[model samples]
Structures are given as C-alpha cells and as structure tokens.
Target: MTQALSQTRTGGPALPQERRLVTDIPGPRSTELLARKKAAVADGVGTTLPVFVEAAGGGVIVDADGNSLIDLGSGIAVVSVGNAAPGVVRAVTEQVAAFTHTCFMVTPYAGYVEVCEALAELTPGDHAKKSALFNSGAEAVENAVKIARVATGRDAVGVFDHAYHGRTNLTMAMTAKNMPYKNGFGPFASEIYRAPMSYPFRDGLSGEEAAARAIDHLDKQVGVANLACIAIEPILGEGGFIEPAPGFLPALAAWAKDNGVLFIADEIQSGFCRTGAWFAVDDEGVIPDLVTTAKGIAGGLPLAGVTGRAEIMDSVHVGGLGGTYGGNPVACAAALGSIAEMKEHRLDARALEIGTLIRGRLEKLAAEHAVIADIRGRGAMQAIELCAPGTKDPDAARAAAVSAYCHKSGVVTLTCGTWGNVFRFLPPLVISDALLEEAFDVVAEAFAATA
Candidate 1:
C-alpha cells in the first residue's frame, strides 16, 4: 500500500484532515437552508436528505452547519475522482478563464477533439471507433439510438425491464420504473420494446436461461429484424447493481450481430473506472456497437458521449447528432483532466480496493442480518438488497429507515432498485480508508437500529 493509503487506514492523521464534524448532522444552518431552498427551489427536485453542503473535499461533505459527513454516494457516482479533485479543479478553473463555451460545432476547439480521442482510446474493444459528445447521458443514449437506426434502417429499439436510461420522453419509455420517472410523463417515444432482465436476486435465472427467455420474447413479440438497437446497461444501474450472469452479455451481443441489431451499452453509471475497469463491458470482453457514457465523464460536469464502431457512428448526417452545448470546451477540458486524473491516480485500482473493503463489511453484516437478502456488485459500485428475511418481498421500509438513520448518524448513502430495496454505495474512488471505515460504521449502526 502507498504511504497515503497507509495514513488513511490509520485513524490518527486521516481523521483530522478528512473528517471533522463540529455540529449535529443537518444542524441549525442546514435546517434554515433547507427551509430557504424549499421556498426557492422547485418541488420537483426532491432531496433524500435535507442537509445543505457548504463544501466538499476528499471523501467528505462539509455541511452549512460545520458538520462533516462521509459521502458514500458521491453525488450519485458523478464524482468518482472525488469532490474538488486538484486536477479537475485546475482544469475547470483554467478552462473557464480561457472561455466557457463557443459552441464546438460553430466554433471548433481543441479540447473537444482531445476529449473524444481520450474516450476512443480508453473505452473497451480494439475496433476502430468514432465518438460524438452530448450534454447528458440521456442525450447520448437518445443519439445512440438514432445512430443505430440510421445505420441499420430499423425502427424498433429493444430495452430490458428494470433498465434506467434517463428522464427524457424517449429514455423514460426506455426506463422500467414508473413512479417519479415515467408515471405522468407519457406518451413517450414509440417503437421501444422491453424484455425481462436477468435479476438473480428476484428472477433466479441463469445466464443461458435469461438469454433464452429474452430471445424467445423478442422472437415471438418484436421480431428481431425490426429492431435497430438493443440497449442494455452492462451492469443494471437502478435495477439493483446486478451484474448480468457471466455469459449473458456476450451471448446477447452475438445474437444482436446475427440478427442485424446494434448492441448499445448504456454505461453511464458503470463506466469511467467506477467498476474497476475502463468500462463494465470489459468483464466479458463484450464489444458493444455503441456505448453511452456520462456521470463521471467530466468529474461532475454535465458532459456525456456515445462512442462506437466508426461505420455506425458515421451513418448520421453532420447536422443530425449535436446540440449547442454538446461538447462545450470547458466541459471537454474537465473531461480530459478527469481522464488524466483517473490514469495518474489509478482510480480503477482504488475502486477495487474500496469494493474489497465494502464487500467484506457488508457480507459480515448480511451474515448477521436476516433482512439483508443479498450483497452484490463489482468494484466500488456495490449494493445490499434488503428483503423480508427469507421472503423475496422487498423490505423498502427497512431500506428507507436505514437511509434515514445513516443520514442522522453522519453518513450519506443512496437507494435504487424497482422496489427501492437496494442500498447502493458509490463512494468516490479517492475516498480515504478511514472515512470509508467510518461510513461503514455508520451503516452498521443504521442497520442495527432498523433491524
């Protein structure tokens, strides 16, 4: 282990610098801020906790009331490199001083091309690739669908149940959850079909069985020939951090190629070293025809991209794929800096290290807690699914209570899954071992309180 890691593992030096809580969590100032926020901010923007952050660095969030909370969620995994990482801060600062946006399409810039080159080189597969930048993961996904359809001359797009693409009309149609994302937000984009995902926690299906079931459904219903893209999350994100069975993705990719369908990997949440790999598809060596990325791409800036086989990406006309802010130079510079940081700091290895620690702790917890139905995921994108002891019925109440308890106890976490039973931990890859240990302690306390 490096000296920094060694320092982090010990509570001596790391605690004073990395975590310092001076007030109760969600203290007086935070409560006041929450009241002001409720008056000013839209009600649609709901918060899991009412705490207001005044600053963040390393792996901890400093709230307005001087309470420092361990940030296990990392702003929904958008800050993989850590909050206010030196490289990212420097790049964003310099880029903003130079010029924020000139619209890459109208006034081309070097930063945009540099980011694309980095993505083309880093993403999985050895195939020649082309990339198009976008403003969000949803836009990248939407554009990937357009490119695939244009390339293959097919109208129907196939998605899996429990998949979460985005909030756009089309992506909401692509998403499986209905409450906040898709309930009143229809009528969505059409010709989008959903097949069942292989969720071992619930479906209990093997890779082959799941693939066969999905293929069977497609054959009997949508007919493969009509499909232009088969969009899947290499690791199901909101559907409970389930890694598809070993051969599941490769088999599906082969089927897509054989049937003239484009395999689109929505790697928005699982990419950029968050999964201990450059891309989640690397686990199986599955080369997707198109891949959508965002979240951690710019180390928290709003930037996303779709990189794929050159021919498929080239099918769209020049005017077909870009938006005004699609590759803003500042965002591009941040992306380049974030990629450099990932390489220099070796965040992928850090993710694995963190995952090893979290898995060990969560497994120990699961062994003791009957409500912890399963503990799963890879690298730093791990989760613990709560259930009603031996029953498959989701223990969402327990999950929510656990989250509530964690928040009050000075730890931050997030929940996912169609049933809201999965508690996902997306700590920044740069998090200190001491802080992670503290967060784990908070979670243990929460579990004990809730259980």
Candidate 2:
C-alpha cells in the first residue's frame, strides 16, 4: 500500500508522502518548459532539477509532470517549517487582503514592529536588541557591516576562509569562494580580509589552536584597532556544511570582545531552528553582537534582518537606516506565522531527531562505501563529503554522478561545497521518518550504482 501521510493543513493539500515517478526524470512537459526557459530566462539563472514544481508540502514536491519527489534540499533550507504551511498561508492571505505595501519607511505598521520584537526575543542574547529588515540575506549582511563600522569607527572587516555570505557587492567581497560567486566580479569593496577557518577533517587542528592561529593572523594582518568586526557562519552553508571544531566560535567571540571588535554571526542559513537551535550560535552559548538572518525567517518570503545590541544598532542617525520596502507588512506577517509554526511544532527538537536519523543512515552508508569521506553538520542540516577512495582528494565528478542519479530516481537533492564534492541534506523539519528513510534508500542505491 502507498504510504498515507497526514494532511498538510486546513488549506494545504494532502500530498502523498511516498515518492512516485509516473515518467522519466524531466518527462516531456518539463523538457518543453526547459526549452522555453532557455529562450526566455537568462543563462546565468540555473535550475537544479529540470522539472517545474507544481505543489509542495510535508515531505514531497510534486513536479509539473505529476511525479512526487522526496524533498531533501528544502529549497536550500528556506522552507524549514514546511512548504505551504498552515500559518504561512493564512497569514499571507489575510495580510494581502488587508493591504499590500505601505512603504514602512513612510508609514510603519504593527507587523514590522512585532517581527522586530520577536527577533529580539528569539536571537541568542538576553540584552536589549533591535533589528532592521530587508529583502535578502545579502542586504542584512551589508547592513551589519554598516552598523559595525558606524559603532566602532573602524575600516577593515574580517572573515574566514570557506565562508559564503551573499552575492551583493559588499558581501561578495566577504564571501570566500571565487568562481560562480566572485569570479569576473572583481573591483569588490575594499578593506575585507580573510583568515583561516577550522576544518576538522582536513585541517586536523583543534578549535583552540585554529582560533589562536586565526586571531594571530588578524592581529598582524589587519590590526585590531583598524578592524570593525569579524563575521563568520557558525556552520558554513555553501562552502560545505563545515562545522568548526568545538571551542572555535567561543574563542573567536572572546577575542573580538576583548579587542573591542564586534562579532557578527551570519546565520542566514543556520538560523530559525534549522540547526536544532533558534540560532547555531546558541549551541555554544556564544552570542554575536550582530546576526544577519534571511533564508528561513519568513516561511520562504523575501525577508531578511540584521539584529544587534541596541547601542550598536542605534549608532546610526535616525534617517540613516531603512529602505523603501525594508519591512514589507506582508513579509512581516509571514515572519510571524513562520515563527509561530516553528515554536508550536517545537521544530528545534524535531531537527535534533532528524539529525540523529539522517546521521545513522549516512554513517551506515559511509561504513559500506569508501568514497563517503566525512559526515558533518548539526540538526537537520547535515552533509556528506565525497572524495577519492582512501584519500581526502575531492571527487566532484563522482558527487555529480551520485546527485544526477538521485535526481533521476525521484528524489530532490542538492550538492554544495567549495569543491562541489559535498552532498548537502536540508530536509524540512516536518519530514516523516518513512520518507527520509526511503530517500536514503535511493541514496544508498546511488552510491552502489555510481560511486
């Protein structure tokens, strides 16, 4: 019998939890759409899956060709609370009915204030905090830098190797990757310096040692007095889901504090219970002076925020901050709804359960397969790096083959990493054990056939 999943929500569809393939991977309709897309859409905008999505909820995404594929990417960790969630749909519907855009800068609304209040309450610190919302993670990050500079009267910003901040010019400079992100886009903003990051599997350095090395580099290279802030992702997202060794973040935070440099945690991908905590910095009791959030903030809406200590955030003049659509009322409503779903469902605990389940399956696969190099990340945000058998050399081709196999087999998966050799798994917190297990069964098959 086909697995019968629970209904999504009041207005949400009752999607089947099981993966089903009615036709080959992209089918005919998707192929036709692809041709249209190629003719119309820019070549730079790429699609991971050739098929177009018609519906998504619970643990599956139904494609235009009527094939239900198990969702493992969660729209790159944007739909952590699940797609078409009840609260999100209800909130957006009601907000759109009332009014669309008032230009919060000219005329503010309650929803924006509520979201800022919620951000103050949820983000890591207990101290008084304030937030400024924007449209994307890059905006949040860029604004964080602005706030840091204004507060400290410094020029240089510090970032680590293998970090992915965003694509905006300022953040593009902060991001560590070259190709696809920074290549041919030079003449980037100045005064951004890069330091070493702690990669346990490859660097083999303890967290303390790595932090010391990085701190020394910063002091010598940038000079503490000239540095404004040190921004880092608690767990790297696109540059591989690389988790720094234990003690690394706390040490960095301490150094920044003692040196009067701000610590910024770019939690764009790891916040909102995606990492078994409200924010990944919460795991080690390391509170950042500023946090940039976006991806999972508003039930997939286009909303981002930079939350920080009141004094730091208020350093700017009254009219110094805000944009035309910084905090759209509709987006704020969606944020409130998303937060409600996350809190009500206790998705943090759910993420932990997901981490345990997926880790067990990946561990078994790694033991049986030599190409499975390392398993890392926390909560539902886990990944497995692929490498040459018995060696740490990255095998991007093998990773591509395995990902292609999964896509062909009715599973929606995504591969990331600086070398493009890590298979990232960011399933919605609402995913069922049965569906996850089934997805991994296909992954195991991919390894057996392609690896």
Best TM-score among the predictions, by candidate number = 2
TM-score per model over all chains: 0.96, 0.98
Q: Against the hidden true structure, what lDDT does model 1 obtain?
A: 0.87
- Angstrom error of the Cα, residue 178, model 2: value is 1.2
Q: Pick out the ten consecutive residues of candidate 2 with the lowest summed lDDT.
A: 1-10
Query: Across residues 196-260, which tens digit of lDDT does each residue of candidate 1 receive?
Result: 88887778888888998998888789998899989999888987788877788888999999999
Error of 2 at 77 (Å): 0.5
Residue 274 lDDT, candidate 1, scale 0-100? 93
Give all candidates' CA lDDT scores.
0.87, 0.92
The runs of at least 3 residues in candidate 1 whose Cα sits more than 4 Å from the true structure, single-residue gaps closed, are 1-17
Indicate the TM-score of model 2: 0.98
Candidate 2 residue 52 Cα shift, in angstroms, is 0.5
Prediction-by-prediction clash tally? 0, 0
RMSD of each: 2.4, 1.6
